[model samples]
Target: MTSRCILQTALLVYFSTTVLAVNYDLLRFQLSSSSVECQNLLLQLNGTTKDCIKDRMNFKFPEEIEKPQQVQKEALLLVTLDIFQKTSDIFRKNLSSTGWNEIIVNNLLEKIHWQIEHLEEILEKIKEEENFTWDDRTLLPLKRYYLRIVRYLKAKVYSICAWKIVRAEMLRSFFFLDKFTNYLPN
Candidate 1:
């Protein structure tokens, strides 16, 4: 009876860990594919904007995020979560300003919002398993990048051309995220 109890306990632990890992991987895959779809949608919308603005914006993805291999998995995940949250904010704020098709833009926002929620879930699970603190400074670059975009939008008076450039920059971000998903541990 004692041996049977031990066996059952061990099996329970094994299955729980396996299920958690699978959930992480599955969430990563879902977020990756969603990012790709968002990228394509952004591309299509950007193409619709007339190329009348000659001014170029210098905003871009943070270097650390661009090179996912160099950063630790936990930190990468945190940064990604932060970026996604910020991206959702941008989408919410500029939903009507893009001057693009409202339905498609809302669809993209919904997808990103979903990705953000799932990422938070995965991160919370990992945090429970591994106790580690991420530095606030790690997010400085992202904050700076986001600030640049905000400034650009304000400078351009949220014009259609300005939103077009912002959309193009966001496309680059989603492209990097899709590639970064492959780096996540399965």
Candidate 2:
């Protein structure tokens, strides 16, 4: 009958639409995974919590930025994190016994600082645009994660600077000590 055929078609369409609906939970899982991977990569690069201080800074989304731009910025961050994570993994896997050259390490550090700066600029720009009136819970986690990373990177930079200073001072002290010893009676 026509009625039976209509009922079946309706049921099929309903089920198909339901199946095509986005799985928000899965997306959340992916987001969390991406964040975790990023954190892990930083840790591997020597940005441990023991060295990096926890920042209490808060981020507020700006109202001037349209929803689409906000979403685009967040996506850009996610992709960038993913790329860093993958590159780090590859570097670790291919690490050589000779170890990384000092110049290379310094270059990498500079690049990391530049990237962090850019991310912070984006966050600042977002906050300065327009007031975010919607459910901010979705973006809060991402912002927090990013701040944590920035803090870690800062700690790493400070540690490197401190290390270089100490090393140079030690070398200078040794040179002086050697000079003093040489001047003493044989």
Candidate 2 residues lying further than 4 Å off, grouped into runs, are 47-186
State in Å the error of residue 71, model 1: 1.5
lDDT of 1 at 33: 85
Residue pairs with clashing backbones, model 1: none
Residue-wise C-alpha lDDT for candidate 2, range 80-106, written one tens digit per residue: 333333233223332232233545544
Candidate 1 on 45-69: residue-level lDDT in tens? 7454457458566786688888889
Backbone clash pairs for candidate 2 read 62-130, 63-130, 63-131, 64-129, 64-130
TM-score of each: 0.89, 0.31
- Position 58, candidate 1: lDDT: 72
How well does candidate 1 score on lDDT at residue 146?
A: 84
